[model samples]
Target: MMSINFEQLKERSLVIRKRYHELERIHHESEWTVEEDALAFLTDAGLVGRHVMSQQGRWPKENTEEELKHKIGESIWWLTILAERMDINIGEATESFLTKTEKLFEK
Candidate 1:
C-alpha cells in the first residue's frame, strides 16, 4: 500500500490534467471546457453509483467490486481536477467541510 497526502495527490492530478490537455489538443484542437470536465466527472460518478447498485445485488454484474473501486478513485480524481480548474483549494475545502459538519454533529 502507498500513502499519499492531499498535496501529492493534487500534484499528480495536475500532471494527469496536462497529459489530458495534450491529448485533447492533438485530437480536438482545443482543451475541454469546464462544463465538459464537469460532465465527465458526472459520468464517472454515475458509474460509481451503478457499481454500488451491482454490489448490492440491485444490478447484476460480474466484477462489481473492482469496478466500484476504480470508479470511486476516478471520481475523486475528477473532483480534484474540477477543483483545480475552478481555482478552489480542494484540501482546504475538504477540511472546512469536515470541520463544519463535525461541529454540526457535536453533542
Candidate 2:
C-alpha cells in the first residue's frame, strides 16, 4: 500500500472542507456557530471511540477493525473541519502533540 504525506493530507482536507462549506452555504439558512461545529466534531469522535471499544468487546455492538478504521478516517476529516474553523494548523498541531507526548513519556 502507498502512504500519504502530511502536506497531501492537509491539501485534501482543505479541499474537502471547502466543498462541505459550499454545500452548507447552499443548503442551510444560517451559518453554524463555532460551538455547534465543535459539538459535531466531538460527536463523531465519540462514535469512532465507541466503535473501537465495541470491537474490543467492551460493548454490545458489533464492530470490526476495518469499520473502526473507516470511522477513524471520518473523525479526522471532522477534526480538520473544526481545526480550520478555529484557525489551527492540523499538520503542525499533530506534530506538536506527538512531540509533547514523546517528551512526556520518553517514547
Number of backbone collisions per candidate: 0, 0
Residues 1-105 of candidate 1 have per-residue lDDT tens digits of 897888998999899999999999999999999999999999999999999999998997877898899999989999999999999999999999999999999
Give the best candidate by TM-score: 1
Tell me the TM-score of each prediction against the true structure. Answer: 0.96, 0.78
The parts of candidate 1 lying over 4 Å away from their true place are none
Tell me which residue pairs clash in candidate 2. none
Off by over 4 Å in 2: none
Range of the 10 consecutive residues with the lowest summed lDDT in candidate 2 = 29-38
Question: How much is 47 displaced in model 2, in angstroms?
Answer: 0.6
* Model 2 agreement with the true structure over 1-107: per-residue lDDT tens digits: 68877667778887877777687788895657678778877887888888878998997887467778877887777787778778888889999999999899875
Model 2 scores what on Cα lDDT?
0.80
